[model samples]
Target: MFFDARKNHQRLIRRAVSAALASVLIPLAANPAQAASYIRVNLIGYQSTLSAEAYLMTTSSISGETFAIKNASGSTVATGNVSATSGKWGSYNVYPISFTLSTPGSYHISVSGTVSANSPPFSVNTTSNLYSQGVANALSFYQNERDGANYISSALRTAPGHLNDANATVYKTPAFDSNDNITSSLSATGATIDASGGWWDAGDYLKFVQTHSYVVALMLVGIRDFPAQMGASSNSDFTNEAKFGLDWLQKMWDDNSETLYYQVGIGTDFTNANYQSDHDIWRLPQADDTYGGSDSTYQYIRHRPVFVAGSAGSKISPNLAGRLAADFALCYYVFKNTDTSYANQCLRSAEHIFDLANTSPGTLLTVAPNDFYPETEWRDDMELGATELYFALQSGGLPSGLPHTDPSYYLQQAATWAHNYITGPNDGSDTLNLYDVSGLAHFDLYRAITLAGNPSGLAVTQSDLLSDIANQIQTSVSQSKDPFGTPWAWGSSDTVSHEAGLSIMAREYYSLTKTGSYATDARRWMANVLGANPWGLSFIVGDGSLFPYCMQHQVANIVGSTNGMSPILSGAVVEGPTNAASSGSLDGMVTCPPNGEDSYKAFNGSGAVYKDNVQSYSTDEPAIDLTATSFLMFSWQIAGAPATTP
Candidate 1:
């Protein structure tokens, strides 16, 4: 069951060296011969019950190929014939081979014949402990992405070169508005906010409230559903990670003025040179400020703008406010048992924001339009916020003198929101409907009606929600265009998020119906995210044999090496595979062609259009919401269903 970590590391090194040497020594003219002579198993290994897949690269079909799985003791424990499944990726034919391991231990696999290759040793275990390990690594990614004075401890740091950002203090003196217009009479002694914390939104230093709130809400839900799996104590990894975001969210809110800052700092589109200049610089967050100077260089500096309710440019957006309210309310519920005072503060803010959102309804927040995190729809956010607020009030003793505490009001609001978005006719197609937060709202309402024992005569019932989820899963599988059997589109991370979200829902459905297929499909999606793809690479970094290294994150790009040895940070899932249409935008950003372009010579044979380059933000940038949802999915998998469900 145990193997020396050092030996495994050494084996990886040897394989890398051998692969490099093979690439150099083998002539380009002999590519066809080399391709025809080797076989590759997509995964490092497989679980006891899962099917193992091996890929044979050849232009011509070969029959009767056999493969064997050997134990660490060099004994063949299982063997099977290679049955061709699909061959969409160039000349490679995928053969799915099945095997079972009753015991938990390390093992290697080999294909029989003249063109055989041995897989590196992998493990098989009965317990869902891999999911736990994955959660830990995913949480560690937040630590690695931490800005300000926080430094990841040596024990937890996967990429040691990624040091803490020295800049913690951020003094905001806005020179230009969101439209690049100069602001008249900008303050010299601007609001000195300690915007030292929060994970970067994606591939940039900007911290967005829209995306951050969604992530925080999902993390809370994960802990609530799988307390044991998520280690729901105060000092636990899940709680710690949630706290990092909570602290940042709290800082973003100015309680005295009842205003929330949607985002901090500008993105690359503002000024490419200034954005790139932050690289390799060890300075405080305050160093970017210009102290009300009219200099052009100072004008290009970052700005931290706040949105006040009913203000000229800051008219309250129901969705943005709803998201903020939900985030705070969930934080209140999660931390109430551990830190009462802090929890009360969160509840107060939640109520204030909820009231503001409910009272003022027009168009969503029109403060700024940053393509990075646009708030296109607000109904989902509104439903999620209402649902969370209802739950928080139900659990944390409804506070006196609060209109938002009416359980019937919130329940009806949530149900109406769900009806408008999810159960409506315009829910969109499977591929087009990438990331839907409305599902979470539906799930919450369903739980309220059944699990929480709340009373509401809403048209949306528990059975209806479950049926919709099942249909969505079926649609995803039926609509997938890839050989890997997972749906993908222009933005692959949306597919990744959708899968993770579906997995979370499937687990809940399994709990209600005791349906085995739900769990089976969930596991299949997880497998695809881990390794079961045409590229044979895990989208999650640092987990599988082949994973992302050159993530499009700015900090990671500056700190990590280029050869895919050191990832931006371990356990971070990048924006996954995109279609060929994305190549044009990516090509304009980087000097070299991004890795997965169809026109790229290397990818021509593989049919892969997803890239891991730093400039390929559409595909390779890691985002907070995706990480949060992925954490939820992994936690649900590890928790599994109760032995005897009601």
Candidate 2:
């Protein structure tokens, strides 16, 4: 290879020549003499960049000096003066200069100079390792969590069951009408649970949080909770009736994993992100600009958001706490259920979120009522609020010194609330463990659902409770009748949220005891949602896609149907807007097909569309009953073209 001149070489030659000439000039071809040069280099680290200094020096005086610096690849990066001061007789010279090296990389220094016409050439090599030990240590900690065995294995058992029990006053009792609307037919079991027409219906809200937790767990663990066999076998298999309804769970996990990282750089929000169709429903064709709108009344709903450090806008909002709470609980559950390898991964994910929350400038703690509204209350948000920070701390091995109290106490409190609010009031008995919401009900249910009969923690005991709940849920479903007198019909009213709660009830009922009725109701609920049109062609994607405009209703119907079913082998249909307001179809005749409204837009364009669209690929989430119906070809027609084939 051709050689490029270095800074030290030129400097040595200049200085050595000057000094040697002062005494005598060697013959044109005199033997080369040996000389040594000392070079000093300094490193500087800045918040955004770095700098370094290098120079060459020789024992004997030289005429002039030239020096060049090179990076690790030996490329001539720069050449500059070797001396800051010059000697009167040119016997000694010094060059001091500083340069920058912003990114992390290695570099080398080469020096060249001449003492006389025939001065000897001397060289020494220096290398730079740009990354600091502290940064490296932190990065290593992150990597350990990513690849460690404990990290991979721990994501199976840490979801929360009773998150919003304290806020139950807002949940209106179920009521539905004859038209399968929210007014007359809505029962805890028969109708959709979130018929109140609120942005966050109780049932839909529960499903969203549960789904969020499930998705977060998968994101942190980087693996599936159920065995491969139990994963989505077909589209309809994603229905809730299946014992292991965790098919779409993986896709949801991937969506979260990809988005959270992107959020770190570009920031988080339903809007203003490069979200793909599956990643975000906010930007979908069915979406609208309702994000900052008021609830039902014209008055503006509060809007607050939790933000990472360096976020440009207000940093006081605890808006992201609910979302974070869901994520942390999922992370904990996944870490607990999976192999040990997931522990470190869980820690890493939690740590990054925590760091962002803690180091963020102007951090505050507490979540106001309007934080969820994001309209009027957006300005009053706090930081380090409940759910996000509290559960996040617990996920990372329950770090001590929490502000409010110990995790055990919180868990007990959660359990007590769950019993008092849900099981106690409804069942007319206080026999259940009412003091274990965080650690027992939410936590235990998460574990039991994923374990698929594996015994661990409270799983074995919870199975029995699940069976009883399933029986009651079925009874409720069977007793459900519309005020207008319709039988065997679902959703006369808009209680979509109840679908999820019921699924959980049914799951608990069957999972704990393996009771057939518990599973039967679960199956019935899923079947009702799928309807005669079991595939996207007629059901969720096309005519019936926008069939039910309630998001909470949709979420409830679809939440737990991801595996081990047969009817929905293809997957859930994509619910879009429809022309339900009109009585005519494309032909505009009395015989025209019903012009369904876009289901995606009906719930005022909540992010529910994102979940419905991506549920098929989610590993832990269940596939819709429509898709599962295909797998159960023995019972239902494959084409889903109005019965008879089976």
Candidate 3:
């Protein structure tokens, strides 16, 4: 109904203009009408204040467009004019509208006069259930991203169910050996390795250790900080999702050889005719191998291989190993009480990997020639692994096979690593401060100082770490240039992860100093992500009125189609808009509007650039790490007790 009015408005404008003028202007305004007149609101709605925006479809600016906020009883609660400050989308202008609701109830927006449109219904409430629901939905995304032994829960099932594959046993190709060495030809003696489990990295089926490690750490933090919020009840889905990744990570290690696999597969060639055939076809996990056929048709699936640790050809990536160590150590700390033997195993493996990584420094994981995740930094990973190992040893007692008999040795290692990281380049200068593990390193170090009892007695004091963290939060707040206060960067998806990181730091800072400044800033950032941005659109799918319907994810796209292509998994956060430098290169991938205009122009105006089309992977792909980070932020906001300080 909203789209019809927008279309009707466009038709009348075309009829009024000259044919020559209409030819150029119509295409700009004639881009497909969105389902809700580009009215973006928190699909889950807001509580204290109701904020939303109406994107005008017309190029000519209408000054006094009457907009009203109406309640479920169809009574107008508030009225205002569309803001004159218009967001330019090529020739079209998107208008802004906001109003405060006096009561908590279901509501929608109605625009009269020049632009006639109605928004989808939403809620206004004081309960934390919305955020809790967001966490649950975000965790469900991992279930949907599962590669083997996928979650079959009726409530969480978004993808087609399948049998376990490549986990029990997987064949090794010469192109990619067990030790991750690259070769020109297939191996003479085919080998089988047990490489199964873990989640697919993004819309594509590849898995990277760098990203996986980041995700696992965030989940562990969620469980640690808000056990009740993360469903600490027996066999909770949150715990189960985290364990899924941990189980797969354990398999990646070969104890005898002291090696770990960085990634399991390669992204399909984007230029190929069968660019995403692996996803387009509904095959089991093991189907991605040569066992089924030797024909050229099967080549795409057959070449997927696991990259392991070793030399230049088979580089023993310290960053990957360090992250793996951190994951194991953190799991040890969390699961030690319930599962002792399993926890002990994780502890032993964590210490071993940490030592191996520290001793063998320069062996970086070489990015497979065609692979996308090439990790460039190792300091943060090393810091996190050491910190977790120190805490695990201190809390859970010593495990057998450790290099040192004294737990303090591990503590000392952790403190040394932390000192180096804090003094290193992880200050707010680099955007890496947002998505990278440096913030985690700082958070863990702060915990070691205030909560964990600074056992190592390293040089830097607790006050220094707290000050640096406060400065980091302030820098992030100041850097946000958008009207909605969401920070922008080269990668919109990475920016989401970065925003989550800032929230994590802000919460920790609040815990330490009882200062509400960072916490208040953190809440605003969360609101921005929800729907308080320039686009007034929630970056998260299925959580807001104008959420992303057509994300660049293949599984979601196909699974969503089963439900008439609405959204598949709720609470799946999409990578938001990026700047020209980042999006310009991917212009060829976008197919919307057909005319090769800036793909960034695809979103409703407000300069909140993004595209819902499947081809716009840069701005629409939902990633595991990003979702994991969001889950952490949501759990903190919803599950943790309300802040007592201002």
The lowest-lDDT stretch of 10 consecutive residues in candidate 2 is 6-15
TM-score per model over all chains = 0.79, 0.31, 0.76
Provide the clashing-pair count of each candidate structure. Answer: 2, 175, 5
RMSD of each: 7.9, 31.7, 8.9
Best by lDDT: 3
lDDT, candidate 3, 1-646, per-residue tens:
0000001000000001123322212222223442223454545665545343433444456787778889999999888877764444544555666566747789887776554556557777753645767777787688778775555544334333223235332223225343333334322223345566688777656666667777887787667666766747522347777888888788777655666665565443333233233433433344455434666654545655565554222334567767788888889888888888888888887877777774345524533532234344566677777777767776846567766555556556666665665676655543322234666666676676554555446656667667767666676656554434454432233556567667767777786777666666566567667765444456776565455555555555533532113436666766666542122212112232233343234444443455545555556667786676677777666644423210
lDDT tens digits by residue: candidate 1, 53-171 = 44444444657878788889999998887666565455555555556666778886677563455554567764364566677768877777665556455332333221221222232
Model 2 lDDT per residue over 1-646, tens place = 0011010010000001123221211222222464433333322111114233333333465544666656556676656555543221122233333455443444444455463121121122211121122112211212111110112111211222222121121221222232212232111211111111111111111112222232233222121222111123322221122111121122112222321201100011222222211111212111111322544221111111111212222222222322243344444444443433343343334333332333232422211111211121101011111222334345445433323333333333333333333333234111111111121133243342243343334212344434434444544555543211111222221122133234334434454455465444443333223321111111221111122211212222232121112112122222221111111111111111113212222121111221222221211112121121112211111111111100
The true-versus-predicted C-alpha distance at residue 195 of model 3, in Å, is 0.6
By TM-score, the better pick of 1 and 2 is 1
**Cα-based lDDT for every prediction:** 0.56, 0.25, 0.57
